[model samples]
Target chain A: MLPLRVKSMPADRKGIRVDLQLVADMIEPGTRVLDVGCGDGTLLDYLVHFRQVDGRGLELSPDGVHACISAGLPVIQGDADTDLKDYPDDAYDYVVLSQTLQAMYAPKAVLTHLLRIGRRAIISFPNFAYWRVRLYLFLWGRMPRNETLPYTWYETPNIHFCSILDFLELCREMGIVIERSHVLDSWGVPRMMGRSRFLANLFGVQAVFLLRKSG
Target chain B: MGVTERKSTGQAPTSLDGTGPIPGYHVRLGCDSPLRLDCGVELFDFPTAYQTYGRLNADKSNAVLVCHALTGDQFVADAHPVTGKPGWWEMMVGAGKVLDTDRFYVICANILGGCMGTIGPREVNPATGKAWGLSFPVITIADMVRAQAMLIDHLGIDRLFAVVGGSLGGMQVLEWAASYPQRLYTAIPIATALLHTAQNIAFHEVGRQAIMADPDWCGGDYLDQGKRPLRGLAVARMAAHITYLSESALHQKFGRKLQDRKAFTYGFDADFQVESYLRYQGSIFVDRFDANSYLYITRAMDYFDLVESHGGPTKLFRNTPVRFCIVSFTGDWLYPTPENQKIVHALNAVAANVSFAEVVSDKGHDAFLLDEPDFHRVLTGFISGAWERRQGHAAAQG
Candidate 1:
């Protein structure tokens, strides 16, 4: 085993992905957070170190769990599809699903569980209705393979891909309250597009939303 | 000469092997500071045998205690003094392994109720001047942790870097976290559960009964009678051994394979390879382990339930400053994954810092001791990260 040196330098939030940075910004210090599909737990680590949040993570793969644990992040090896039911209601202040909503087997059920398990939920996913994706799918009768959606039709883990408007409609039907939303370009740069929901759906390559239970 | 002189001390009517101090690596507690067992009895002059590796840095912040499982001794990273076999946990406690003796002070002790140069049923009771035997107070997992805490106090370290263990050893680790959370920075409880299940208790009962039913057992005074219940202990070991292995593993290793002969013996002899292997395991085990020790230890485990002591399972870590890594094996029915998840769920309820890993392996309950790279990888990461967190905490305090 490689000997790991404890590096005490403060987390450099500037180097984090733009969407993740935005999500991190919404979380309050000292609150409990659970990151679903927390790949290697970079966001959880950042939240713990910089935001002083009580952070936890859940990853489906053993390798990702090992990486997270090795870094001293609290992570459980579990699938979001079924493991969410085991968590107590309002167990966390914020439940995060960054860029992993599309890969879920039942996105709607998982979304409902996120709201049920946390006071607020943060979800980020590629928007299939972005101009480039729509044009690629419209021009070629194949699944779009672009900068934001890179995997091919057969090998992609994005089984339930949806547009930004589709997600809003889902929240509407499930009685979820969308407290805040953000948009990002294909390059992961923050975009000022959520001002007009329609234009954001048409132009934004990715969408992130902070949601809460309506009742 | 030493044995005869000590026998006449005339305090108790206990069996006397030898009176001149125990001959191996050990720590003796004096009568002035007796170990107060959970049973409300104060055990005096109790000796705890332990082995340590690596150097303890000046600040004494790098000490790591590795608790051994049932049938395991203090030979964590060295050759066993009795069997000449490599240490039980050499895979994860050596120089370059996850515990990494080169970087931390690693210590392993024969548990309080163990026979290997420790205060167990084989030890003479000073009060009665006799082999405690069946008279040795039944020890609980918490009692074992208390003894370890004394050892730690004796070592002069205020706090430990981490406490780690698997199976029965894992119980000790859990008890340490619950009873003395401030004494250790982190805990790694592998292939274990929050409590012993009814199924687990039933299995242990079968083994204990097997030992007690043996004629040569002499009603737990087999030592004074100059006899060992080899047959009964062997049978008990054989039965318990099956629980440590998975059905898939057993099938893959010895599925109806005949022993030495092409066909089964027409009589009541060991014909199958699995039977022969089990017989060999049982016969050799009796040579090193005492049947009475097995009874006491199994009883201790059967009585273990963290909820009973800490209120509820979820309340075990309430308001505690402990970081935990709980691991389980996919094929381990003895202490299955769901049981381990209960622990993780409890930790989560209290918002305690915890991680849970369900490793894929066919080695059953023994997987934690095997060469599963995923287990090692998880430990390596957990320990390194915990160390880093400790450093961060120290920096903040400064």
Candidate 2:
């Protein structure tokens, strides 16, 4: 049979968002990876092309699932909240969930499943305790809405919104090891807040963490 | 492998049996070795009518077997001989289409208990020299797959590139994956479930009862008795047709509007447009379908319980290497998204490589057959990807 031509890669290697690029950086080349809540498969395509990873995706929306599959990415139409448990233990080298943890009904349960399914879990989410968000809620006495958190209380999918400190405490309680971490400013650039959890939680607009099960 | 000899009896003269001129390719399989069916009956010297599109490459890895639905025939991308209409899945099977005959060798066969040329209740039984009718051994979905496996074997192809279908065809796809996992590289079961629900069986029962209640049915021997239970079969088709569509689709296609007249007719003479439409659908269906074949096929579907036969849902696909793409549509009430998802979950539990998509459609259970762009795109992407992966595996082995 004639060899079919593979699709050409996107010209821009740095086209993905900074947070996603950070998540991509943590993944080792040619390892099995699953991206939970993989909307449009931007991160997955990047990982497959650049990192040479065998990537799979789980997306909730029908539109998102179709879009991912249409781009030739293997994606399932499923909710991360309920679908993650179906994966076998350590099925992937890395499991990535970006910007979707706060919207989960049970963020802790999802995190547990993520860590169980992959050797390591990479998660990124907006920090509700960021100074600007805290100030906006303090000044207006209303649910803070910004570019990162772009919805009102009733309309928001971010039901279980949490601060960076809250997430760190939960990880500690669950006996999860924080392998590496990054605190991003509003522009999605990593801020230099080494060894200072208080300043990171107080100022970082978003946080990304690489975690693994405690020994 | 050498039990049955492969020979194509190309275009034999119209036989004395009630079935008309043979169409397309017909092969007489299991002549020396009979096919042992689920019902403990062995079928020998059975004929399988099939059609092929594109060309099988030298390595023969591009062959894709498309399983047709209950009423569908082997005419995957061509015009039907009897109906003169386009093939059922023409939208998804031609050049540049989702199945893309240009790149893939596509094959479809008339299923075991189907009326379109394949051996069914309408065919003559060699022992009795008459139509089998109700005497035809009760077959199941497994029986259908067993027959298809025979055809694939006779064609000199060991492993098919893919086996794809929707609805009952989808059930056959699942059966293929379960019973012959090593024979196919990828499986695409769209708008189907691992087993038939009680509601599904109930609907089939209604259609069966409608056919049996007809005075002209002659206890399933209508063919030999010089009588055709057209009305009974038409009613059965009409009732079964409703289940294949969504309530919203019905409403959208034919509301409370009257047929041919602005006002409703007091007498029961197909006044509503919906009534007339269904009546027309029923009337045309009997022209191409067989009453006894309908009964046997529906019974086969009703008896399909993968969990019962395969131990359990998750157990059915344990350690399978075949890639799966399970597709469901939002408006398909017959086999809803949740039912399809159960198959995904089962595959997931076994760590089988599977992709699933529930395409958004208001067209109901028939959405898989209709012109849904999203559905088309998903199929295109999946087939192309699976092809690429198959190539990758082949190259790696080399």
DockQ of candidate model 2: 0.63
List DockQ, one per candidate, in order: 0.59, 0.63
- Residue B208 lDDT, candidate 2, scale 0-100: 94
Model 2, CA-based lDDT: 0.87
Please list all clashing residue pairs in model 2, or write none if there are none.
none
Model 1 residue B76 CA deviation (Å) reads: 1.3
Specify the highest-lDDT model's number.
2
Mark the regions of model 2 whose C-alpha exceeds 4 Å error after superposition.
A1-13, A139-142, A191-193, B1-19
Across A90-178, the per-residue lDDT of candidate 1 in tens digits comes to: 98999998888888899999998898889999998878899988898799978887655667778777789899999989889988888
Q: Each prediction's Cα RMSD?
A: 5.4, 4.6
What C-alpha lDDT do the candidate models reach, one value each?
0.84, 0.87
TM-score of every candidate:
0.89, 0.93
Candidate 1 lDDT for residue A19: 72
